[model samples]
Target chain A: MKILVPVRRVPNPDIKVRLKSDGSGVDTEGVNFLVNPFDEYAIEEAVQIVEKGGGEVVLVSIGTADCEETLRAGLALGALRGWLVETDEVLDSAAIADVLAAVFKEESPDLVITGKQSVDTDNNQAAQMLAAKLDLPQACFAFKVELGDGKATVEREIDGGLDVKEISLPAIITADLRLNQPRYAALPQIMKAKRKEVKKVSLGDLGVEAKSATKILGLAQPPARAAGQIVGSVEELVDKLVNDAKVL
Target chain B: MSTLVIAESRQGDLRAATYNTIAAAKAKGGDFDILLLGSGSAAGADSLKEFGAGTVYYSEADAVAEYTAESYAKTAAALVGEKGYTAVMMGATTTGKDMIPRLGGLLGAGMVSDVIGFDGANYLRPMFAGNAIATIEVNTPVAVMTVRETAFDAAAPSGGASAVAEAAAVGDDRAKFIEYRLTESSRPDLGAASIIVSAGRGVKDAEGVKQVEALADLLGAAVGASRAVVDEGLLPNDLQVGQTGKIVAPDLYIACGISGAIQHVAGMKDSKVIVAINKDEEAPIFEVADYGLVADFAKAVPEFMEKVKALK
Candidate 1:
């Protein structure tokens, strides 16, 4: 069995990002980047499944040369190899799904794991779209997964509760939070990853049509809530909640 | 081209999302027919009709008794394929979030998720975890979209009658639902709660969590927690309110000892009235809070409870 994991590089979640004045996109200059936090869980889950089931884990990231660092991070975390689909052009979820679907056809992995959504775009579409494009079953928001006998049982976290689902091999599964805590790649592992060669897969080679179905017309900062005055005492706060706010 | 809005229900109760998605469809500037796909009773369709959708199409089968992205998407995609609906809308709730993308993919349609508003053909949604908003335009002949319930008002449920039509059954055998475990809580559901009292890392132990819950019970508010607290094992994951967790816009949101991160704020910032109580006066949460109190939650939470009880 072979597992394919897709990782994305996104701005550090802690830092407050600002939109460019021209509204083309977020200002990425002088900003730190890291593998999307959720994607780290995907990488970790893929590594664990391989470690238990006796197969290899492959990491794929679709972006420019900057994404090589993210793929290396996945390799350090225990993936056997990396595929960097180098594309300087920005790809929407649909286009990204097309690229992954093509990879799915080429690699024919038994399973594909991905983060439920990216912190940057928060679209949460790629995994399901890929499943549909590949004509496979999917389980998103997977909190727990057990693989056996060519079948995978997934416990998914939904809005109200949990849904336990069972799907056959050659399926797509998206990881949610609480799936597992990603391990820190030790210094020795980092050195090994540095020496490992990352194969580049280009959009032209995949023959994936990458036209975006949607266009981002503009970007702006969300309206900020004005911080009100600090209350001197608890009574003062309660008075405002009851009278001015009328929420109590 | 006619639009179709999908209706959702849980445990036979019409979900607030059904009405909220109706509002989103109305915001797109036209009336729409609605479809309820499940074993849910006719009351679900009748309730949706009150939201102003005049035509209700439905399909039911034992195979789709439980919601699965595969089955629901198949049923909805079939309807869209047969009717050639111009747009299909649903709320970006957990079910819709998982199902809409699959439906869009099957139809090869352009999709916008978690949309807050619509300007003609453009859709407004958050980016970078709510730090910024982006307006997107879809060019596909058929557009599939999900609405951010917090950004739209719930449509009134008293409009008029709707004609009911039974649609063909859709089927899929790709996956099986084994079981479901619903969170049992006496408090109101977080998404529909009028008031929410959320705790953070500062509330150290299980006892501290109890204090937050007690206050919530007294005020008839739902209990919520920051991701930090939930990750620390101080509360259950269901209680988490953040970007990865539940997004709530209650009338009153009280943050107890929560040092606000952007992720946490993204879930509750749209709250009508925010009150932050933290010992750290400079906690970023105060930046979005309507009222701030710098004090230890152990001392502040109990004292605030007393003040509220006195008001009663």
Candidate 2:
């Protein structure tokens, strides 16, 4: 079974966001990047699958050239290999899905895995779009999965509870944070990943290298928050809410 | 001139999203009839007559009672193909996000999610998390889009004139819901709340959440938190407001001690008024905040409360 795990390289969640004065985009200069936290679950889930099933896990991503380093990080974590579909700019969810659909056709993996949403874009569209494009079964927000003969039983998260779903092989599944606790990479694994090779798949090769129809017009920053002066006690604070804010 | 709208219904109740879809259609399509699909939702469907829905279509079955994206998409696609409706819309909830792409593919329509506004099927949505907004033009005839709850004001629940429209039986063999769990809140939702106050990792501990709760209590506002704080196990998942969490569009939002990640901002940027309180004015949250205060939050929070309390 070939398991594909596609991830996004977003700014480290631990790092504070820096917005430009015009509120157009984040200041990426001199910023550290890491695997999207949600994607970490995808990588971990894939690794666990291969570890149990004895097949290989292949990690993939469609992003700018800088993401190559991030892809290498996936290799260190335990994927057998990596694919970097290099592009000059970011692709919208649909365009990204188009590229992935073409690649999935070639690879013909038994299972496709990706983060439910990217920490950067947060559109949460890629996996379902890919499933739609490929006409494959999809189970999203997967909290757990058990693979058997040609079938996969998945537990998906819903508003109030979990739903048990059974799907055939050759399906697309997107992982959420509750899916799994990703393992931390040891130093030895980091050093070993330096030697692992990454197959750089260009957008031109995917046959859907065209620019997206969506146009980004403006970037905006979140409005400011006012500092609250702490009262002497919690009791005082509650009173303030009742008397001043009149909300209590 | 006829439009097809999908009213999101669950557990015998018509969701707030149904109204948003109607508002968008009234503003986008000159005429539209709403198609609401769910089990035990006939009364909810009948309630849509005032919202410009000329007709309401509902199908209820034991299996369809639960929200299955595949089943929802499949059923919606069937109606769309035979009826040849102008467009299909869903709320961008957990179910909608999973279901829309499938519907788009099934109906061969283009999909736009988290759209704040639209004009003739050309829609605007937040991209790069919330750092930037994109306007996408879908050439597909049956336009499929998800409207951000805050993007458009919901029209009055006058379905104008509505008749019961029959739909095919609900069949969702691809997915099934064996069980579910939820974190139901008694207070107003953050998206619907007029005032909101949220805390972040800067608060350091669960005890710190009290300050947020107090502030929210004072303002009669909802309490929210950054994903980092939620990840820290300081709050429930529902209290999280961000890209991976709940999306909000309150009239005023006060982010306390949150440095502001793009994902967090993406969820709350639609709020009419934003205020950031942090010791580091350089924090990205200040960029979007209409008001910024640089001071020790511990000190500032109390002072602000005093000023607010004095008004009483």
Candidate 3:
């Protein structure tokens, strides 16, 4: 089984994201960047599956040349190699899906795994969009996935429960929080990752254009929350909640 | 140029989020229709008739009885094409999030997800864990979108029945639904609850979790837990409230023993009123809370139950 896992580079989630004063976009001055947390889960899942079944895990990403750093990190996690769709253009989810579909046709991997959504945009649309673009079956927000008999059984995390779905091979699966704990790359693996091959390609080479179907008008900080008062006792808290807030 | 609202149902009952999606479409100031699919769609269609829809289209074929994105997206896309709908909308529930993007892909339309509000013709959606709101514009001729249910009010019946129509069902050969294992709970659903009592790592153990539940039962509120508690196996994953979990905006949210990580704050900061109780007075959760108490939840919860009972 050859598994294709798409990853992304995002602002380190630990740092508080700040907006520009003019409401244009996020202020990225000195902010650290790393692999999106959800994509790490997808990479780990794919690597583990390949380790057990005697196959290969391949990583792909779209971003500037700096995204090679992101691919190397995935390689250290056990992927055989990487492919970077090098571009600096900001593409929306539709454009991203179109590019991935092009890569799917070129690589012809048996399976595709991706993060449910990037933490920055939080759109949560790419995997489903990609599946639709390719006319493939999809299981989104997968908590547990088992592969055998030319099919995959996925336990999906839905609103109030888990929905079990079975889809044929050559399908799309998006990782959720409980899929697996990602492992840290050891120093030896990190050094080896530096030498692993990462093939560079352009959108033009892939027969896809970086066209955005959506435009961002502006960005602004959310309204500030009011400072709260600390109560001295539980009686006072109840009195305030009942009389002042009337929320009880 | 009319909008189409996709109605969602489970176990033969219409979900409240469908009404909220209608309200969102109404807020956009346009004539909207309803599309009901799946096994019980005919019965569900009857309940949506008075919601001011221009029409209520439904399909109850066995092939489309359950939702598989491949089938539903094909069906919805075909209907959108037949009707020439300019915009399509649904509540940003799991079903909507799972299927609508595929609908957008099939229609080759630009899409937006989890829209909280509108700014003129553009959209308002959260980013970076709700720390910033971005205004977005879909440049496609046909636009597909999902609105956050908590951000809109449920549409009431408008005293007029809409024209009902039957739609063709589409089937998928690549996927099959097996089963849904729902969490059995008598308490109110966390998403729709008016009051929520949430516990944190400070709860310590399974016994501590029961204390939080007891307080929730007394106040008739839903019970929630922080990610730490859920990760520790003291609670089910569905009971978790945070960025990666369920996002709830209740009328009153009482957080006990939670330290208020930014991810947790992102999910609940939009609540109408927030109360935080923890031994550490300087926990970050206190920043967004309207009321803060510097005491251990184990000691304060019993007092809270006693005081609430006396008032009632």
Candidate 1, which segments miss by more than 4 Å at Cα? Answer: none
Docking class of 1: high
Candidate 2 accuracy as TM-score: 0.82
Q: What is the full ranking by DockQ, best candidate first?
A: 3, 1, 2
Cα lDDT, model 2, residue A80 = 81
Docking class of 2: acceptable
List candidate 2 segments past 4 Å from native: A9-37, A63-67, A85-91, A143-168, A200-248, B119-121, B214-220, B274-312
True contacts kept of each: 0.80, 0.32, 0.82
Error of 1 at A175 (Å): 0.8
lDDT of 2: 0.75
- Per-residue lDDT, model 1, residue B142, is 89
Q: State which candidate has the highest DockQ.
A: 3
lDDT of each residue in A92-158, candidate 3, tens digit only: 9999999999999989999999998898888898889899989999999998999979999999988
Query: Each prediction's TM-score against the native?
Result: 0.98, 0.82, 0.98
